[model samples]
Target chain A: MTGPVLTVRDRGGQRVATLSLGGLARRAGIVGAALVVDLAVLSSAPGTPWWPGIVVLTLALVAAEVPDSQAPLLTLAVAAGWWLAAVPWPAPSPGRVLLVALALLVLHATTAVAAIGPPGRVAEARVVRAAAGRAALVGTGTTGIGALALAADGRVVVPGAVGVALLAVAGLAWAATRPTRQ
Target chain B: MSGWHPTHAHLRAVVAGFGLLVAGLVLGRVDAIVLATPLLLVALAGAQSRPSVVPVLEGPQGALAVHEGEDVVWSATISGLPAGGSVAALHPGQRWLEVEPETGQVVAADDGLATTSIGLRPTRWGWRTLGAPAVTGYDAWAAWRWVADRPQPLRLTVLPSTEQPDTTAPAPHPYGLVGQERAVRLGEGTELAKVRPFEPGDRLRRIHWPTSARTGTLHVTATHADEDAHVVLLLDAVNDVGSSGGLVGERSSMDLAVRAAAVLAEHFLRRGDRVGLRVFGDWRVSFLPSSSGRHQLRRLLNVLSVVEPGTARGEDALAARQGLGAGTLAILLSPLVEPASTQQVAMLTSAGIEVIVVDTLPAELVTGDRGRSPEEQLAWRLRMLQRRLERDRMASLGIPVVTWTGPHSIDKVLRDLARRSATPRLVRR
Candidate 1:
């Protein structure tokens, strides 16, 4: 009478997440391709360091190869690597920063798709496609905003009032995005 | 059912975005803020899109009854799932219950409803509990998951496949009102019994004009009455030898006995015979009096489905023998594991019950015992030898012991029993 409920626990101790050699290779290829793009864009910036790019690449690869449970940590590491790469006094160009952000998004999306289910199970094509499509939409919007910021003639003044306003907006965004528990 | 919880994917994005934003503001880095802005936007969008209503799962329900190897679709419908997409994963509780394409993805329609199905095939016969498969619903972004709470475990009753028996058994004794069997006492039937002088109560329709004219007297045709027979199936559940691998694996002695009993019961019941059952094992002896009809067959099979091998008790065997009715054809289906069952058969034959011993022991047991030590093997061989001697004793006493071989397994034995039933035999007072 009752409908089937999805449980997190694996019955019969069955391994739900499995990584096949071919599946691993396919995931590795996606991570490798993303890394190449990230490195290429970061190197275009005049003062970008090589170590940060290498660190991001390593984290991205690990995220793609590990299980879903551990992939989030690696994803966080990749973000931290990006932050390290942007630490120089004279920041990278807005265009290059935008490109690096897009690359990181692609890596995160791909890793999420590859690692979500029972072990060794190949994710459905539709799921991967949806994730990619969403990432692309968000990336396009970010690119447009970055281009506009670069076009502005003078530095925007951060008055205390404006700073307070921006902080409030960020706070609102955080509150709106917080996950709700049943 | 567990409540909604944030997935690691969502948590990672939120933590990384906030960490970068705080670090950028503290360190006076404009590029870092720009970099963190996109991730924060994504996290915000995912969080705001989370629907207030959780999906109400409707089923994994389909056929609760099926034959071995038959496939049944287990499906669940979610009515309140937000329009976008979700993933549903089904995990079967038992190995014998196999699910095809274990997991499924569903996209909700404009009405916010999605239905998903998985094919399940049960590989064995019995009343088996199809463990409650946990169905977890994941959001499109794989950010949030909710587990539905199901109240009861799903149950599947797998019936054994009925093997079509190619041979028929002649009724040893028929005593019912109407049936297919030819009765000894003449009354009214299709088969002619004899022609005799017409009696006062004889109907005019039964008169034979030619016989009346030749004999110079009124003569009427007499025929035999058709009566149904009572068949008693005695199943030995004292012990199960060898390993049972469901439908695909090697059948244990208990499996053989149950399947064979089902086949015989179906055959006789379809022929208008009243069939009964008696099972003796560790538990008390269970008995069902002879009855005829399709419902009776169901009752017989239901009883068989719950049968399990138990410790042998000599008194249970004797108690099972007491349930046998006079003039019934009692078919003893057993592996002959215990000497008490052998004695039970000897008693049934001596009581003029007309018994047939169907040897339900798997042939693999003789060679399969190789896994044991040499001394244990010797003991098994000696026990088998004694079993062989018991069978020989039954054969000498005019009881036919047949080994089940599917289709025509009992044809020869039944044919011989038919021949023996025609001759006069002494009846115990």
Candidate 2:
């Protein structure tokens, strides 16, 4: 559904602008930005099955083009990525790992957006954002720890670790402020 | 009670985010994938959410009487809660509405329960019904999502605008039986009669004491003849306010006519006069005519309240009034908006009934907006002239037209009516 909103009109012919497409685009962008941060953390972590987690993250980020339920799908993808990273795989280049992280943010945003129709549930955005924000916090923490380990080994993968934490925190904040379903 | 609201845009956002997450996962961006993944899921849940709304309505006989400019309160009791959340009811109308979240009258039960009382004032009159209502809420903790369908609706009947009465004057002559009109001989009234003078057993009051004393004979005075009057109300619907082409509200000449008719009917009934009504407008739109009793008044008011935009269709013509024979004082309530309506009233006057025309039309059908060009001003003046001519024509036909140009109390018509009514005396020649 486009999400539902009540509208009122008067004799003067004034109409209220309820759920508009512009809001949808913004939500998608928010989820997209958050996914980008999350992917960075997963990339820098060591001893993680890089491919599967990278693959899921790629899906989430790319799907964020729509930015609706992509957060949930993105979360699943991130979980899968983590599981895959736990398995053994060929050593990947830093640049390639970064690309996978960015992909996750894109996928989540785009895929979730595909589900929206009309009646514009502008209120739901907040709830979804809040929930996504909490999950983002956890993901960011894991990214930070991974970055610290790399730093101790003189690897110093600050870019990936910091990006994940910041994006997660941002997503959480956006979600918390939005008016979503109770 | 409980519901979720998932916007399509939110879902679209999820889909977009999901696509981005997928790409990030394929690219080996673990942190980005994890962050984007949660957002995708959240968007999905929100997308799936449905927002539901319910509204409670109550009043005497299930109908509420809301005065003009007075707020009519609509109370909605909400239940079914999500964690860490509150409910909000929003109506996007210009009518300023006051919403009270918690009040003494509101009772709450369960995890989340709140009542929203909204107040609205009607600036004008007529019928109005509430559209679909929307209710939305979120978790207190700001997690998960919920939405429900809300179709709460209420119908409102806003009564017309009216002003309170100022210093009042008693009616000159009471028209009804209770007021003054009493009855007499061989007939249909309520007054008592008397016994005449007697040769032997006559009472003192009946003896005509002065006449007996002077003439050595007794003669008694007898009483007869005083009763209620019957009135027939005739409405000229041929010329309407809309046809006049003035300011939308002022142009509603028909509204004025109908309102006048209603007042007349009410006043006559109160005074115990038998009142019958006839409409010259398109009665097919829903017309009930010529009846008596309390029920008839209700039917008349119902017709008056139910007004729709219409034209002076040829359905009710002046010639059709030929059936009104005589003695029935025909009161024609009209705006004289059109020349045709004027001609109709003239014909009525020529026919025999003492016809009174309550002309409610303002000569200026339109006064153009400010800063108009000379050409525009000329056009407005021409329209005004046309209306003036129509009024003059009707007056020239010997019809007593009471031109009601206001800022005047609409009650003037009712007051004048009660005064003019007198007992009808039939003389057999």
Candidate 3:
């Protein structure tokens, strides 16, 4: 038997780096979604500084490495909040809101798909494509909700008590449906 | 019980969506609600589609035994996952086993059942125990995950690869009544010996009409008897010199010895000859009695697979074994690095058995510096000189030693032995 150093050296000599094709595609999806969201932020808040966008992009890259972490979701929320607070006035047009909502939808879906396995895992192509389809479905429904909210804003108002009760009920339902940990 | 559990994606969606919705309601910002809408829907979809039944994970599916260098696909079957769910299977890395995807991770999705597989190619021969594969199930949106319990670990037996030794030389001593070799004594056979006077029990076809006409008396042809030979392979496992680089890479002395022994055993057994094996230097000096057939070949290969280099203490025990029969051709495979291995050669040759010594040392080790210090280099050179002197001594003692070079390495030695088998020699017993 030889020493561990030589064994490790020989093994290193024999190893060849392998890149999973599926992993590359998933990473691309993450970067693409981040770029779309960043573009929407830029269009929504034209006066905002550029550094925040760069920081969000860096976080997105980190999320690409570890999609299971909170970096992706945190970056998405930061981007959406910056746009909401940076822009002055009654708000950006409905078209801008539609674009931002669609990008956020893609970011969430892609990050979720990437989290299904480890960084090196090669996910099936059909599954990723199916996830994209599901994201598009959610995007369509979200666009409809945005249109409805915009149309009914000045015409309707709910009592403060009813809104609080609805929030409490939704919170209770969500807490009850939380998965039990083994 | 449901094995499904919420994943981090689900938690992130809920926290982010709910936080955004509450903030939008408090500030009356329509954009926050728009932003939270998709995440809320995704979280709701994942919660609604949570798997109700646990997936059934089965044992590995693949060949449990394979020859070295052959590719094997090890897979696990999982059922009862929800539609559009995905499963990821992972088999941890093992020594001498090359796993495709390198990480041993594979992910696939199907209706309710799926099989995930990883490719394994063993680089060396011996028993390899594979760690139990890890399987995880993910729902359609990956909001929920169910990790199945690990299945039983796979135990694979990698048999030594047979390096075909291109030696058609007949065994020096044919001992049995039925085989490919022509025996010394006259008997019912095909090869002509001579025309002789008619003997009692001579068949009518044995009559030589030309000889009978010339001699004016009945004469019959005689032929050599067809018989089989007994071949005993004596393996030297006292020391495994040099470094092994697996099947396709550099080979050490022990690797050469085992592969050569397996090759010779298969060659002899395939020709309908009785072949046996005696592994020296093992704890008990493993021995397999002479036998013929496919089963014997398998048994011999199995024995060769598990041979570990042993100390000198087992030599005496090896000497005491009684199965080395007379007229048996014993082929001793060793690097002759240790005195004990050379002593084995002396013992076999002294027993009046036909013996051939195959040098199993790698050629490069004979001259390479091997990154040794100056003092160690000198010692290595001296050892090589001693090995050379030992080889010369064995040759002078009427024992033939040949270097192993894969196929055809022993053809000349066997031919020489066959030619000399007729000469009478002294036997101690």
- The fnat scores of all predictions, in order, read 0.21, 0.04, 0.43
> Per-residue lDDT of B1-429 in model 3, one digit per residue for the tens?
347878878887777777777777877777777777888888778777776777888766443878889998877788887898888777776777787655445355677888888788888887768877777888888987888877777788888888777777988999797888888998977889998999898999999999899999999999998889999898888888887777988899988898888889888888889999988788744788889999999999888877778654445733623688668899989888777767777777778888899999999999876545898888888989999999999999889999998858888998899998999998776
Best by lDDT: 3
TM-score of chain B of each: 0.89, 0.61, 0.93
The runs of at least 3 residues in candidate 2 whose Cα sits more than 4 Å from the true structure, single-residue gaps closed, are A1-13, A16-182, B1-78, B84-110, B114-130, B134-251, B262-276, B285-297, B309-312, B316-330, B347-354, B362-390, B393-398, B405-429
Q: What is the per-residue lDDT of model 1 for residues B1-429, given as tens digits with 9 covering 90 to 100?
A: 555666676666666666666666676665555566666667666675666667777885533777777888777776665555564555554766766555433333235666666678887677887767556666666666666776245678887767777665666788788777777889778889999999999999999999999989999999998888888999888888877777777788888888888888888888898999988873644787789999999888877876767854554455756756677889999998789888888778778888989898898885456346899888888888888988998888888888876757887777776677779888664
- Best-fitting candidate, measured by DockQ? 3
lDDT of 2 by residue, B44-71 (tens): 4443332233322221123454533567
**Candidate 2 C-alpha lDDT tens digits along A155-175:** 433456446644744664455
Model 2 scores what on Cα lDDT? 0.47
lDDT measured at residue A7 in model 2 versus the true structure, 0 to 100: 47
The superposed Cα distance between candidate 2 and the true structure at residue B209, in angstroms, equals: 18
For model 2, state the Cα shift of residue A3 in Å: 25
